[model samples]
Target: MARVHAPRLIPDPCSSAAPRRPLGNDDAAAALGPHPGWARLPLVVLATMATVIASQSVISGAFSAARQAERLGYLPHMTVRHTGQHEEGQIYIPSVNWALFIGVLVLLVVFRSSERLAIAYGLGVTGTFLLTTTLFLVYAHIKLRWPLWRLIALGTVLYVVEGLFFAANTVKLFHGGWLPLAIAGIMGASMLTWRKGRRIVMAYQSDVEGPLTDFIRRARNGHLNEVPGTAVYLHPNTVPTPLALSENARFNRVIHEKVFIVRTVPANVPHVAPQDTVTVDRTGADSDHITQLTLHYGFLDDPDVPAGPRIARDHGVDIDPDTARYFVSELTLLDAGRYRGMRKPFTLLFMAMSHNAAVPADYYRLPRERTVMIGAQLEL
Candidate 1:
């Protein structure tokens, strides 16, 4: 349909009487009108509405993508608000929305016209197409185990088409095409740095936290004074003892009478089954009153720390949510003066991202009044 009408919508440069103004969507709308009269007004209005709907869809998609990235550990935790009760994908990310708004404002001020902006848009779209095609081909080959000849034939055809599209846009590199590429580069760098930094920080934390089983055994042996309340430690994994729990035992020299080490695991699916949400490990809970609770949440599911206890009760683990005091770790990154693994600038970027990330209490929906943050410093 577009190919059939494009010639009428676009002016021919070879024509001597063609207008000097740059062609755009407005021109296309005008072409769709019956005549240069009242018909033009309605067409323009319709075009405007269509553009608005498209932009809104893009913004909503961005919110979902950002939320998923944060959940999957590709990005820093952001404030995600579910806007729809029945739809798990209906979410709003204020940070992403604001960033997009600012980016659009800057682009409008700099480019000033659709003709100039098209260069960057074309590059971004074509780049995405090329990458998506490559990824699809790779997935088919590796996962589906496509025969070598079939893989080569399909890949050759797709790559040639995508390569041509990408190569056509590369000529506009200096003329605003660099904007999208630069943005992609920065975002990719940030995601990679955050993932790597998280691993390094977690390794350091695990080393410092020692072993969870050992700590539980020591507490069971009456090595520390027993307090009379339930303490819930929110941790990323069940492998290492939570830094908050270890820190509390170290500084206060007291262990809670009943302790629950809770770890919220982000599953690969969109929504985990309600029945499979909470699992309790009572390896030593019956004797020592120390239990290990694992909460499974999908990328779209909310990680409510307070609700974990209620869910655990269904699994035969009794926990009082109202009186449980939640403990979380607040990590402060110290200067890594001579770190060799990650560059200094990337380290600084990671620290800045971590500093701005949503607080654990808010992210996990823990009770603010009963939540306690244990500060810990990590150098490198």
Candidate 2:
């Protein structure tokens, strides 16, 4: 039997006349042979599988980053689900996943093909590369102890190359690059608004709340009603007087027998052992009965406020289960207009976020029946 040769459908890379270019589906199929059905099937399946795996990896990374940002106080908190028993990094944020799903659908519908989407993808990749390269320069120079000349040399080359790539991608801004830029803008604006709102709110509270030591002194002298039971007030810092406690005293004129001002600190690591995460400091005189509790959590850990009793007991202050009450301060953004740092549109956005953010009782896993929310109005 004589063999018949099939036509060369795809260009050979080794040939001088065949210029390198992205191969189309048709080219791939044709390259297989005249009867290319079976041969091309595996190739198509492999390519699809690779794409799916890459996409899944990217989505996982996005979830991890979003959760970290939320923990770091840059973004609002979302419910996180741990998929693995021992893997702290295996987290799923429903909101982020849904948003990404919708985003992917919109992109697919709008772009229709990978050719058009590549511009936007390229823009995102280049922008991230530039940002990472910039960070690397700083880390290399300061932390890695690279020589000044070496640092400058490495940074300049990386920056020049990445900057050029970013600049080249900018040409596609109107075509498809606008998508990532718009997303980036929204994220940047959100992060900025949160940071500014937090700063302004904290400063306002600090100015109004007064010193913790002074409050403890006053409380000891019988300034407020010494109510039965332990009162746990969650504060951002170790401020002796928490906003919740101050408000309770000013309005209600009441204080619990043993007052605990607790603050949960987030560590950069994945998981902090429970035993090593709690610190208790007994403040004021023996008669005052004021204690400060600081709980440390890994960036991935869910904060548990109900553990306050256990933590207190570990430090020798036994909290009565029946009498304990958790107090949280809720912010009401008064439409009295904007304040310093946060202005107009962004301020409104921040206010909306603040209004919708998860309540302390829910986010910190406090006992709902024993939690008290005291609302305070703020201008910003």
TM-score of each prediction:
0.87, 0.83
Flag regions of model 1 displaced more than 4 Å: 1-35, 283-285, 336-340
Expressed as tens digits, the lDDT of each residue in 317-372 for candidate 2 is 66664567899977678767655676688888888777767767778888899999
Model 1 C-alpha lDDT per residue in residues 1-380, reported as the tens digit of each score: 45554445666788977778777978987888755677788999999999999899989878877787787798998888888888877788888999899998999998999999999999999999888988987898889888889878988998899899999999999999999988989888999999999988888888999888898888878888988999999888887788998899889999888888888898988788878988888755676888888899887789987887997877677788988999998788888685537989998888889888988888889889999999688777
RMSD of each: 8.9, 7.3
Q: Number of backbone collisions per candidate, in order?
A: 0, 1
Clashing pairs in 2: 212-241
Q: What local lDDT does model 1 show for residue 373? A: 98
Off by over 4 Å in 2: 1-35, 40-44, 160-164, 320-323
| Clash count, candidate 1 | 0
lDDT of each: 0.86, 0.82
